[model samples]
Target: MKKMLLIFSFIIFVFNLLTAQEKEKAQPTPANKVLSKYTKEFAVSLLKGVDDSMYPKIFKAKMSMETIRKGRNPIKFVYEVYSKGSTKSLMEIVFPARDKGKKILLLDNNLWMYVPDVSRPIRLSRNQSFMGSTFSNEDVSDSTWEDDYDPEITDEKGDKILLTLKAKRRDVAYKQIDMWVNKETKVPIEGVYYGLSDKPIKKIYFFNVKEIAGLLRPLDMRMADLLEEGAYTDVKLLELKELESVPDYKFDITQLGR
Candidate 1:
């Protein structure tokens, strides 16, 4: 009986030793491997630049939105977009003559749409679809990605840096995003937004970089819906001006269509 007890104790000890070895193998081996020198702070600063390279802080932009889907004619709309800081924005549709004068306001993560004849402003969520396009309301809204995501530099290619952004909170539109940025220009090259299950939900590419508002920025953005093949949206910036500031009342829900 004593020998059997001794044998059982030996087996338990060996099992625990093997378990510990497995756990050690699972942990990152930074000491043994040459790690990337880029720190979190550096990653954050680059991301902030990438955000500004897309749009200016206080500006009014004229853009066109076109949505293409399989077995359907492409739908297009033109708009004037007003933005202030990182939390407030207003988009007014100006084309498709019949749909003109419609406005959408984004304050923080909340959205409100005002139609020409509607009595009240319709409340919307930033996570929902924006005007039937593949881009979400948050995508159209003025938001600081650096605040919502914690960025990590994963790779550096010839002229681009690849970053893996993890959502800082659960309520965000994407759980993770793999973004590539042009190192010299600070303009985002492309990104793939992933869901909570790590499934790629959308892919976005930036093009047509030019000097706008004293900064080099991408004038055209394309968002492809990963779930729906051949379904995508293109938002092209027609006009942009960086202002000192935008009027406060322009973002008021009650002042949507005014």
Candidate 2:
């Protein structure tokens, strides 16, 4: 009887050990949970006007790019933008007769420009200017932070949360970005982009907050170059719409000319 009792006790101990191990596996690690929360918040803040749908969201907008500089007439270009989700977009110059039929395509991380005069689309670097404006190809492209950046909350002030974002891959335009977001609305108020040297190269401000569709988003975005004096670009969204579906071919490079 003593031997049987001892054997039963050993069995119970082993079972308890196994159950504890299973519980540990089921619970998420603290580090991972923290990172996941930051990522979710960053994604929501970055893609403000987008819906939480598996399908891509489409936005149609009239964009006015105005460059503020000294000794040069304030250059303005009007464009019709078609954006799909946070990965693909196409912009066509509409008002300016000289630039009509010119198209800019953002497919994944690649940017291409198709001009009526050029036989084929010219691949553009993310750092390149968008139509000679202060906005870079990367700036105009629609992309989510979760895919390209890893974010962490560095500080929480009264009404804002400061987030530091590091690029997950080298292909990203900016190596690092420091952003201040509204804690209650999850709207990005300001962002500073840093180069590989960890120095700020550009700053962006989000303003004119309003509700479009069901999401609250900033209607105006202004970017200022840190190195350039009195040079900045302001982009205002005249119209925005979310689409139910966008055909995949619209983002294809081959269809850019059409």
Candidate 3:
């Protein structure tokens, strides 16, 4: 009888343990544990603010670029933009000396190729390569960040989050891009760009993070060309200052011809 009682007690204990395990499994994890609070909806809202914060109303920027070609030393091109984004106002950069001295007025989409002998505004397409580099007018056109990219959280793996971005319009360069965002920093660690195919046409790695306007922004970005061997582009953001006020007219393409 005592033996029977012991067996019955052991069975009951096992049954209780199994029930406890089932109950533990049935409990749902907190949403924060399973998914980042920044869902697709939240990312969309955050992106709106992020885009606005990147642009200042009136600002000056200096870009020094090194163009690489096969079997040749890279050529350096230095330029600056004095933009209100209000009018079609731009300044051609004079390099080799004077950090901020020589400035030429560029009033139209036609950028005058200032040669030592000839002086005339040459009509150029936005798609033309700038100084043997992949940078074109489409790359340099003063654009609103809000109009360029939309970040949506699509998936998550462990602590890394995947974000899918759809270009606002076909007039923009990239059709689609996938970003791998850090769960903690809310910043994109890496990005892949897609063209007409499922394969990524370009892979980008961002580093050198610095605080800008209370948010961390990538200071250096390296983009690798998938098609061309040993071809790549590196963009280093120098300074980004927010503008106090900018006229709405700054966004006009007609201003490009001004």
- State the lDDT of candidate 1 residue by residue for 1-258, as single tens digits: 999999999999999999999977554312222126987788889999998888888999999999999999999999999899888999999998988998988887677889988999988876789888999887887788986898888888898998888889887888888888998888999998887666688999999999988889988999999999999999999999889988899998877757
Count of backbone collisions within predicted model 1:
0
- Name the regions of candidate 2 deviating beyond 4 angstroms: 1-56
Ranking by TM-score: 1, 2, 3
What is the lDDT for 116 in model 2?
Answer: 90
Clashing pairs in 1: none
Query: Each candidate: what lDDT?
Result: 0.86, 0.74, 0.57
Q: What is the C-alpha lDDT profile of model 2 across 1-258, one tens digit per residue? A: 999999999999999999999977554312212334456566445434122211136767777888887778887888887778777888898868888888888887778898996889999888778776777787777666666677777666787877777788987888877777777777778888876655677899988988775666788889998878888999888877767766887778888777
Show model 3 residue runs off by greater than 4 Å.
1-40, 49-58, 83-91, 96-128, 157-159, 183-185, 197-199, 245-258
Model 1's lDDT to the true fold?
0.86
Q: Quote the positional error of residue 11 for candidate 1 in Å.
A: 33
Q: How accurate locally is residue 73 in candidate 1, as Cα lDDT from 0 to 100?
A: 92
lDDT of 2 at 10: 100
TM-score of each: 0.84, 0.77, 0.60
Measure candidate 3: CA RMSD: 13.8
